[model samples]
Target: MTAAEDVTVVPANEASWDDVAAVFGTTDYPGRCQCQRFKVAGWIWRDSTQEQRTAMLRAQTACGEPGAATSGLVAYVGGEPAGWVAVEPRIAYPKLRGTRVPWTGRSEDKDDDGVWAVTCFAVRKGFRGRGLTYPLARATIGFARERGARALEAYPMITQPGKEITWGELHVGARQVFADAGFEEVGHPTPRRVLMRIELSIVD
Candidate 1:
């Protein structure tokens, strides 16, 4: 397991595109989706080509530009790109507006830009099972708070102890990951999914 001290998190824009791609790899859902699942409208696989999705991710991340806006955070373990977490204003994800998961029992405005969401997490093949998501999840709190978000939310899957979940199903992260990061459960939209959130008090 990589020590927490060996993990470093940075805004996606500050990391190079190569590092981002390294985390996404070329096979798996993360590779094919490229974190554009929520960014695109309609069924992602039907609406966008692989190349188009990749391009969209690149533009959203704005990799290699420190001053540009970024939509996520990248984690480096021992100086190698190991993971990524997609976080940005909830308004940035158009698909969420039409999705039922985030709005089942909640009566909040769907267009709230002050609310941010952690939509996906991807850990590089060689770096899995090392608790990288903990730091990545922890990082989103300050990342969103510092960016002026009123609150940060995540829709994570509920995991069972003996049940084996595919990486594709857990890409949004397991519920405990966000809970450990100080997120409180706000809603349970499905039998297997929970909406967790942390309210942030922005300081001027």
Candidate 2:
């Protein structure tokens, strides 16, 4: 078995589609989602078929093609797939543009593609509580900056002890998780959700 301390993250495109699929698994929210929640929006998202979401994720990841631009990152522990996180330009998430959770109190241009976002995460069942999200979140900073991102954002739940947030709801991440990665809570869009961000450009 791969030790948690050996976790190594790499761009999803650098990994094979099968490895990515292994992280996503075969049941529950992560399996059904394939991390496409933010890619499709509104009725389209509700109406889209599972097969469609899977195909979209496959193409989006561009797995097996090392040179293709990937939409997320994957983590491996001792050569075994362990986790996945979707990090890409904010503009790449179509559902986020029309959403209110990320912009409730902030005055910012919604069209900036240079602004990146961590939209989703999936940790393999056996690897839960191994602190995989920390490195995944930290990696987005350099990944986006290297790709010309001016800012990086995440919508994380404000988890409290004794609170039982469903795995599906917490898939975006938790407040403390991103905070540990150096993100600041800029907007409290809801009682349970917070909009956290890190500014690379210092413009907003």
lDDT of 2: 0.87
Best by lDDT: 1
Mind giving the per-residue lDDT tens digits that candidate 1 earns over 76-155?
Answer: 98899999999999999888888788999889999899999999999999999999999999999999998899899999
Q: What's the TM-score of every candidate structure?
A: 0.96, 0.93
Q: Can you give the lDDT of residue 17 in candidate 1?
A: 98
- Span of ten consecutive residues with least summed lDDT in model 1: 38-47
Q: What is the Å distance of residue 45 in model 1 from its true position?
A: 2.9
**lDDT scores in order:** 0.93, 0.87
lDDT of 1 at 126: 90
